[model samples]
Target: MNWYVVYTKPKWEKKVAERLNAIGVVAYCPLITKESQWSDRKKMVQVPLFNSYVFVQIEEKERNRIFEVVGAVRYLFWLGKPALVKDSEIEAIRSWLSVPETYEVAAEQWKKGDKIVLESGPFSSQSAVIQEVKKNHYVLILESLGCVLKVNKKEI
Candidate 1:
């Protein structure tokens, strides 16, 4: 069996995962707790780490069974075929999430145009170039991911 990415309806990742599991399919929906502020107060809420995406482990012949669950739209396609998530990648996510949240990174002076490799977090081991250095955060360009990421000082 291989793990495949499933696209879900907006804000339905958790529900779809649950429904899939109820039907005997192994589903994983990674979640992270974030502090949300309302007008009155602040609260910590668990949100899906990847919006509208859930991972399901199933055999290729049984791929169509996933559609039996509501909110499960379709499988994510890459290079014209269903995207397969490697077992090592899935284990990495599990290990990353299982570890304690406390992280202590030695503060280092970083300047613009500096090339650095991330030592932790989701993009660990990936190199990024510092695009802008601000007092509270740094904007980095991840060429491999083709996205600009804003990393706060506390998170570095």
Candidate 2:
């Protein structure tokens, strides 16, 4: 059997994955624990790392049955056929999430000249290079516009 990508309804990845597993479909929904904060307190929440995507190990014959599950929209197709995910890629995700702290810290260990991409907000989709790293802020040089800006660690 090969791993295929399944697109689920918005915010239904975990729920869809549970239903798939109960029906004997081997589904993998990768999650990441993020520190969420309200005014009073902070807590960690397990959120789907890939948002609406889930991986299912199955044969091509089982496609129709898999799509019958609630919230399962369809398989991700590439060039008119269902895309297959490599086993090594799945294992890499598992190993990375196994030691989540290491991954978080490694992202923060930015050295000068390291390339970084803005993940969200107004400056999103913009690529910048590290000019310097301060206590908790990064000085990035937006080369395309010839601008230097200070951004918080979380912004990247």
Over 5-48, each residue of candidate 1 has an lDDT whose tens digit, in order, gives 99999999999999999999999999988999999999999999
Model 1: how far residue 47 lies from native, Å: 1.9
Model 1 residue 8 lDDT? 100
Error of 2 at 6 (Å): 0.3
The TM-scores, one per candidate, come to 0.72, 0.65
On a 0 to 1 TM-score scale, where does candidate 1 land against the true structure? 0.72
C-alpha-based local distance difference test score of model 1: 0.90
**Which consecutive 10 residues in model 1 have the weakest lDDT in total?**
99-108
CA deviation > 4 Å runs, candidate 1: 36-42, 88-104, 154-156
Clashing pairs in 2: none
Candidate with top lDDT is 1
lDDT of 2 by residue, 1-156 (tens): 899999999999999999999999999999989999999999999999998999999988887777768999999999999999989779867865775252122247788999988655444557899998887777899886578977666535
